[model samples]
Target: MKNSDSGARAGALEVREEQDPLLHRLMPSPDPAARFFWMSGADGRLRIEQCDACEYLVHPPSGHCPRCGGDRCTPRPVSGRGTIHSYTVNYQQWFVGQPPYIIVIIDLDEQAGLRLTSNLLDCAPDDVFVGMRVSVRFLARHGVWYPVFVPSQAMESDSA
Candidate 1:
């Protein structure tokens, strides 16, 4: 699919607008712990928090490392490559005129336990499965970009 901004294929997925009211309601305000994450997203990169003291990569960025209690952490860019660890197809109409969507728990290849919960796009919900190789595509809404995943080229070729 053509990316709105670059007119190129947007990673492996198509970007969708953030129309879910609940999602908008729950979106965290930019703060110290997560400001870098948002900034990186705006800059078109996927960054995960890494604890300087223990080298632990933390998702859902926190102020301190859960493993070492270290407050010294920094945002680190990742490969944006991963596999579907788990997922669910939501048919409920949380937003009017929206179709069913897949919510996936992705296991990032960068580190064990380094996972992210995000939407799976550019494919039917029925096509998503555990262990499916996928890559990230950034979607922008209200000037903030969020990462969504789509089937990797290998998977697409395998299906073809």
Candidate 2:
């Protein structure tokens, strides 16, 4: 089959090598930030960028902090707790096995203006809405455990 993403960034992603149940990876990104992000996913954890200088948590990496012009940074594990700020169901998809999926923008807990985009699975796409509670789940794909979100199971059971 033809490749879906042929961009440079996609080329750099870890492609899965199937040997058994565990992922066999090659040349994982050595940058601490990237390694930290991927490592967390492997462990089913979620992380956001932490500004080392000012203690501000940033969602997207920047050359300098907007809050405090400090350059130092680290990847810190987040609570995996968030609210769905916005979302969309992609009825027509260009990627395989990903059609009819929901893409969500999540606002993380505890860090002001901290948010990220990810897929929402194991839920009815039409049911997702703004301000919905969500939590992270890692889906192992192409030798990586990508961080995806779904409605919190705990919240659902509690509401029952």
Candidate 3:
């Protein structure tokens, strides 16, 4: 009998945020901007740009705040609950090991335009759409659970 969860030899969705050889061998990604995003995911916390002075939430991780235009900036935690601002189902593979996936821009509640890119699970790709609600959950790999979301109505307790 052929063993399942095999053959594909491909790893989990985390590979999307894992080490990129061309960027930095020792680091997950050579790109500093992206590294922060992944690192926070590894910690199970969603961080976005924030106003250091007034502590207002911001996005795009800019140096200055749109509220005050102040250079004082800091990273802040997000609720991780959001509606599907927009999303697309990848019918074609842009790279090997990547099957058709849903890339979504989560319109976070309690924050505006603070969209973050993430993979959607627990639902079909075609089922993914704007305004669909989702909640963040972590996908564990090598002990670190990265931020991943799925369709959630209410938190369910695991019996199995």
- Best model number under TM-score: 1
Tell me the spans in candidate 3 whose CA falls farther than 4 Å from its real position.
1-35, 95-98, 139-146, 154-160
Better of 1 and 2 by TM-score: 1
Cα lDDT of model 2 by residue, 1-160, tens digit? 1223222111112223231122222334556446566556665456667888888987665545778978888777667778998898877645444347688898987675688887776578778989988866565555556666767663244234
Q: Candidate 3: worst 10 consecutive residues by lDDT?
A: 1-10
Give all TM-scores, in the order shown. 0.79, 0.70, 0.66
lDDT order, best first, reads: 1, 2, 3
Candidate 1 local lDDT, 45-110, one digit each (tens): 578899999989998998679998999888887767789999999888866766887889999988
Quality of model 2 by C-alpha lDDT:
0.62
Supply candidate 2's per-residue lDDT for 23: 28
Runs off by more than 4 Å, candidate 2: 1-32, 95-98, 154-160
**Candidate 3 lDDT by residue in tens digits, 1-160:** 1112221211122333442211111323345544454556564466666787877677666667888778877776566678888887767655655556677788887666667776676567767777988766555444334566666452222111
Q: Candidate 2: which pairs clash?
A: none
RMSD of each: 4.8, 10.5, 9.1
- TM-score comparison, 1 vs 3, better candidate: 1
List where candidate 1 sits over 4 angstroms from the true fold: 1-27, 154-160
Candidate 2 residue 95 C-alpha distance from true site, Å: 5.5
